[model samples]
Target: MNLAQRINAFQKLGIFFKQFSTAKIEKHSNSEINTLFFDAFKMQIERAQEFNGWFTKENVLKAFESWSEALSVENLIEWTSKYSFSKNTSPKTIAIIMAGNIPLVGFHDFLSVLITGNKALIKQSSNDKHFLPLIAKFLEHTNPYFKNKITFTDTVLTDFDAVIATGSNNTARYFEHYFGKYPSIIRQNRNSVAILTGKETEEELALLGEDIFQYFGLGCRSVSKLFVPKNYNFDMLFKAIYKFNNIINYKKYENNYDYNKAVYIMSLFNILENGFVMLKEDKSYASPIATVFYEFYDDFDNLLNKLNTEKSDIQCVVSNENVVDFVKFGQTQHPKLWNYADNVDTISFLLKL
Candidate 1:
């Protein structure tokens, strides 16, 4: 489609989403137009029925609502407008290795690459193979042209114009070795951390649960650590997040949580912490399994120095105020067409390309 046509289509997509109001959501009890979302709903429901743990209906609804709101035409256009790839500049083939930590985790990449008029060669994570296909099928119903551009595969990849891959630090070595020669965005192990100022309320603490347990702390965007003042009390925070105890298990996630928890507790000689994760004091960003440790600081100057020193390894930090001009976390992953993860400026990379 031409740029004008594409813009119009996106506008309609936004309106169509808005039309699926809360009343309609309750009345229909299923998403009809977006069969993909319905498929996700069914998958989640089946999981809940068969397994001990999964997201509640309320959490799933909130997640769906968040997706709908973020994918609205206004947000989509606003995010992508700055980097509307010119027909001449857009790559013809782009390889994307998606993360399966959260539901629809890599959707932003799929949407961005395709909307920018590039072919997406997606490698789905074994952890999450179902959701992307369902979404793609829904988009196919929305517009048939999407089918030719978005393809999922495990085949050997070569000759892509560009590449984007997210994986653990160990896997990152391999990704950089393989795709480094070309224009690429290789994301290694990155975790989001929260800075507690002791001024937050119970309501905000509950919202922070969204940042931590939304995807069961599986997504890279999930807050796996907290930075607080020295000797900060956990009474309020733990009490607030106690309601999400159900997030610790599902079918597959239970296995992960159990295995990781065992390994950590065994190594550290401790029992499972109250939540799905363990809290300890650490100087690093990543944590083992469901365990997220924290560090206490006495002063803002010390915090600033620590952040500056650790900036190279840090990806996103969720805070009430703008801690840094670049890093952000907590429901702000509505990336533009060109906003590469891990603070990699895509325009500069594209210019090199």
Candidate 2:
């Protein structure tokens, strides 16, 4: 298919996704395939929750809604506008090793490969095995040309020209060793942080709660750490985030809260809690599931320098007019199509391949 056909298929896929959010699913007259795929995809979404504990229905819908908003015709055209696709160049096979932390986590890479006229050999994480294949089927049905270009492997990946892998710091070393010879984009563990200037409104803090509690804080874009001014009062923070207390009702999250709280208590470490979430003073960027770490900043310039020096360890910085290139309160999860993961331009990388 040509570039216009590819874009149209994805735009339809986005519309298919829009029919599955938490809000009422409205049937659009323009969407013909919805009658064929809607009920089946809904069943898959329900099945996905059973397959992975963290893949709650609400979280899955949230992911779907985000993608629906992102894959507009305008977004697809703008995101691909920077690249030139030569009809003479043969398509290459790109193997994608996806992480299963959040729902449809590796879809951008999958979309990147396909949109750039390359084949995708995806090895999805066992924790998130169900959804992508069904979506791939939808894409194929939307545009038959995608059928030969997309493949999912349960066994070892082979016959690929390049690789895109996302994993922990440890797994990154393994990826580097195994795929070193090939052209690749191998990403390591990275966490997002919020910089609080002690001037945030209660509304902004509540939105920040969404940034923290969404997907149970499993996404790399989730804020795991915070930089606060000295002597910052967390009373407002706790109050604003109280709406998300229902998150603790999940047994898995409750277990984590109890276990982490116990560990802190036994170690006699000073930590704050609001029954659902825990706050501890830690310099580390990566926090445990039920906890978020906070560190005090004395000098703004020094804090900026430190964050710049450690950019590799950070996925996003959440703030309001406090830092350069910062994502606002609740927007870290709703990244635009052009907001590439790891700040690595996936489309640019694919165009080169």
Candidate 3:
């Protein structure tokens, strides 16, 4: 199939999933679509487990479910329209450096490249090889022609029309020095933080756990730190999330939990230690293992000044209102077909390219 055909086919798959999710399909007689996805996902998880103990089936299902919901057909179409990639005069190539923090963490990049009728050179994270290949396999089954477009490799970074790299803040310097010659989106280390005005209800606080504990708090979009008004109680938050004690891997997480706790104790740092989580009074934007750094705010002006200085390391501030220009921390790296990393507007950048 041609590039346009591949893009249209992938778009159709996205649309099918959306319709299936909302029970919007007219003939509910066929439930096979849902089962097919589940079976595919199960196979992917089994394959991924061969790589490491971290890629558990339960987590993989959760991640896929979330992506399926977020990338609805209508939303996908809306995002692609904004990019105008389908209407471009010349086709382009996109190189993606995917992150392995969460299952299918690089889905957005895959979706963008496919829907835009461009070839994608994907460098799969060692942590994410199995799941993506499974997705590619399933897509190929859906349409055999896509087999060539979604090429996966560990090392394929050369002569690309554009580049997108996600890594630690320090790695950004390296990516810029290396891939800077081309139009690139280089993301540095940034942590997501939440703001508490001390008025959150029990339900809201529980939902906040979804932002924190989901994916084992591994993604850049995960809340690594938080800002709160002085004297905010932790009881309400902990009590709300205590139900999820089983979700955590006790042995593995405890090792990290103990290591960081010991380091903090030996260094005499002012840290709060809960059985499952740790809270520290630190100025750093990122937190330690199984922990989140928090700072007390006396005034909003002081908070703003502090935020301005650390804006480069901060990804998003989850608040009731839109506190910063960047998307909420949880929303970073979660572009549809149009949104790009580093908060870059994909349409404008691609059009110029």
Best by TM-score: 2
Each model's backbone clash number: 3, 0, 1
Candidate 3 lDDT over 148-226, as tens digits, reads: 6677776647657998788776777988998978997877777778887778777777667767776677777778787
Name the TM-score of candidate 3. 0.84
Candidate order by decreasing lDDT: 2, 3, 1
Q: Per-residue CA lDDT of candidate 2, range 10-63, in tens?
A: 998887787777886556554567767787878888777788999988888999
Task: Give the alpha-carbon lDDT of every model.
Answer: 0.65, 0.91, 0.68
Q: Lowest-scoring 10 consecutive residues by lDDT in candidate 3?
A: 20-29
Q: After superposition, how far is residue 90 of candidate 2 from its true place, in Å?
A: 1.4
**lDDT minimum window of 10 residues, candidate 2:** 24-33
Best candidate, lDDT-wise? 2
lDDT of 3 at 246: 65
Give the C-alpha miss distance for residue 142 in model 1, angstroms: 2.6
Candidate 3 wrongly placed segments (more than 4 Å):
1-8, 15-40, 141-145, 247-249, 322-340
- What overall lDDT, based on C-alpha atoms, would model 3 receive against the true structure? 0.68
State the RMSD for candidate 2: 1.4
**Any residue pairs clashing in model 3, and if so which?**
169-189
Query: What digit string (tens of lDDT, one per residue) describes model 1 on residues 1-353?
Result: 54445545555454444433323443243356644455454555346323323334444444445566666666666665665355445457889998766555677667656666667899988766655676666666667777787888988886688888888888889999988887788888777788888877887777777777765666676777788987688888888778778766554556766787777667874432675656767777777656677888888778878877776676567777655453333453433434456778644444344
